[model samples]
Target chain A: SQQGEEDPQALSIQEGENATMNCSYKTSINNLQWYRQNSGRGLVHLILIRSNEREKHSGRLRVTLDTSKKSSSLLITASRAADTASYFCATPRGKLIFGQGTTLQVKP
Target chain B: EPEVTQTPSHQVTQMGQEVILRCVPISNHLYFYWYRQILGQKVEFLVSFYNNEISEKSEIFDDQFSVERPDGSNFTLKIRSTKLEDSAMYFCASSEDSPNGYTFGSGTRLTVV
Candidate 1:
C-alpha cells in the first residue's frame, strides 16, 4: 500500500494568498512530517504533527493531522514568491516514505 | 544551523560501473538515511542507518546497493554495478532521532550513460 499520497499535484497562487495542500496515508502512524524543496535543491524540514496532535504552527506555516481520518494538511498563509517549491508529506516506519509532492507556485 | 553535506553535486558514469556517493551528516545526529528522486518523480527511500548498521531499507535497495558509516562521520552509499535506471538525484539526510525532523543535503545528481 502507498504510505503517503498528497492531493492537488500542482497549485499556483498570487502573493498574499493562502495555499493549502493535503496528504493521506495508509496504515497507522506515530507522526507525520512536511517538507519543502526548492527546485533541484534538498528538502527543508517544515513541521511535524504527531498522531495525538491535531494542529501545529510555525511562523507562516500551519499543519494539521487527523489520525482517525488518516490524513494531514499544510497551510501556508500569505504566500510569497520564496514559498514557490514542492511540498511533500512523510511518514516514518523505520525508513521515512514521502508522498508525490504538491508543486506550489506563489507568484510575486 | 548544521547541515548534511553531500559531495560531487553531479556525476556522470558509464553503465555497469561502480559509483560511491558520500555524505557527511550533522555531527550530533544518530540516524542517517538515503533517498533518491528520479526526474519528475516522488522521492524514494533507499536505506536508513543507525547504530553503525542498516536499520531498514527499501525494495529499491537491491543486492547491488550497499551502505556504510566507515569513520563515524562519513556515511556512504555504493552501487556495486550501476545501471541506466540508477540515474537520479540522491539525497542524504540525518536526524537526532527517527521521530525528529531531518536535515537533508542538496543532493547529488547521478547520470548513468
Candidate 2:
C-alpha cells in the first residue's frame, strides 16, 4: 500500500499527561503533516514539518521528523480532555497519503 | 480563522444514482484536492486540481469520478453512478503551494443504500 503506517493504533492518557504517536512511511517525502479529527468530523490540520526541518512546535503541539528513518512523531503536551481525537500522520509528495490514525483518548 | 466548508453533512442515495459533494475551500488558496476515507480505513487521495486543471490524480479516480471548480468558488466532486463501495466520507482540502499544510472541510458523508 502507498500509505503511511501509524504505530500504537490507540493511546490513552489522563488530563495533564503527555501523549505521543508515531508514523512510518515507505517512501521519501517532501513534507509530513499532522492532523486531528473528532469522530465523524472533518480533519483539522495540526502542523507540518518539511524534509529540511527536524522539529516544530505550535503552542502545546510538537512534531519531530527523522527522514533517515522515514518516520515522524507528534507530541501533545499537557493534553486536555478536549484534545481527545484521532491523530493522523500524512506524507505529502504531490498528494497526501494518510495512515489509519492513532486514537488518542484523554481522560478527564 | 478561515475554514474549508462542505455542504449536506450527510447524504443518502440509492445505489446507481448520482451524487455531487460540494466544498468551498478557503479563499486565497490556489490548490484544491479531494480525499475519501471509508469507515475504519485510512484517508485516501482521490485527486488534486490547480490552475483550472487537474495537476494530479490517483488510480482510484476512474471514469466514474470527476472534479470541477465549476465557478469562481465552489469546488465539487461528482460521482456519476454511485455504488455501495462509494459509501464514505469525502473530504475537500486546499493548500497555498507545494509542501504547504492543507485545510480540510468536515467532509460530506455519502451513504449509498
Candidate 3:
C-alpha cells in the first residue's frame, strides 16, 4: 500500500523543547516527504529525504530516514508556539500517500 | 516563489448542488492533482491531470467528479452533486515531475449544508 503510518498521533511540549515524530511505511519507498498544516489552514512543504540519505536538515528541522526499518523521523528543535501544527509524512507511489498526522502543541 | 493557486477559500453549498473548484498551477509544472481531507481524516487522492487529460483517479472520483484544463492555464474540478459527506478541504497541487516537486495551494473548504 506504501501508506505511511505516523506514531504518537499527538504531542505536547514546552516552547524551548524539541518535538519528534515518527513514520513507518509498509513497503520500500524512494523518498519521504514531510508537510505541516496549521489549524484549518493549508499544508506547507517542510522537507524531503531520499531513501539513500540517512539524515538531512533544514533550519531547525531535521529529518532522518532508516530504510532498514522502513521508518523515518522528523525533529523540530527549540520549538515555538508558532510551531503548533499537524505534521504528516508522505510517500509517492504513482500517487502521494499520506499518514495520519501528528498534532503537535508547542506551548508558550 | 511560484505557487498553485486555488479560488474561493471557502464555499457553502446545499445538498445536490453542483460546484466547480478552480485552480491555477505553477506555470512550468506539467502534472496537476486534486486531493481532499475530511475533518480529522487522512488526505485522500481524487484525481491527477497531465497533458490536458486525466491520467489517474481514485474510486472516490466517480462519474460525478470531473476535471478539465479548458485553457492552458486554468484547471477545474466539477462535482455533479454535493452530498453531506462531500464536505472537506480540497487542495490543488502541481509538480514539475510526477510524485515529486509538488507545490500545494491554500485549499478550498467545501461545506455541504
Q: DockQ, per-model, please?
A: 0.82, 0.87, 0.82
Model 1, B1-113: lDDT tens digits are 89899998999999999999999999999999999999999999999998998988989999999999989789999999999999999999999988677889999999999
Model 1 residue B42 CA deviation in Å: 0.7
Query: What order do candidates take by lDDT, descending?
Result: 1, 3, 2
Query: Per-prediction count of colliding residue pairs?
Result: 0, 1, 0
Error of 1 at A58 (Å): 0.5
Best of the candidates, TM-score = 3
Q: What is the interface RMSD of each candidate, in Å?
A: 0.9, 0.8, 0.9
Minimal lDDT window, size 10, model 3 chain A: A1-10
RMSD of 3: 0.8
- lDDT computed for candidate 3: 0.93
Which stretches in model 3 have alpha-carbon errors above 4 Å?
Answer: none
Clashing pairs in 1: none
Estimate, for each residue in B1-113, the C-alpha lDDT of model 3 and write its tens digit.
99889998999999999999999999999999999999999989899988888889999999999999988888999999999999999999999998787789999999999
lDDT of each: 0.94, 0.92, 0.93
Cα lDDT of model 3 by residue, A1-108, tens digit: 648889889999999999999999988889999999999888899999999999999999999999999999999999999999999999987678999999999999
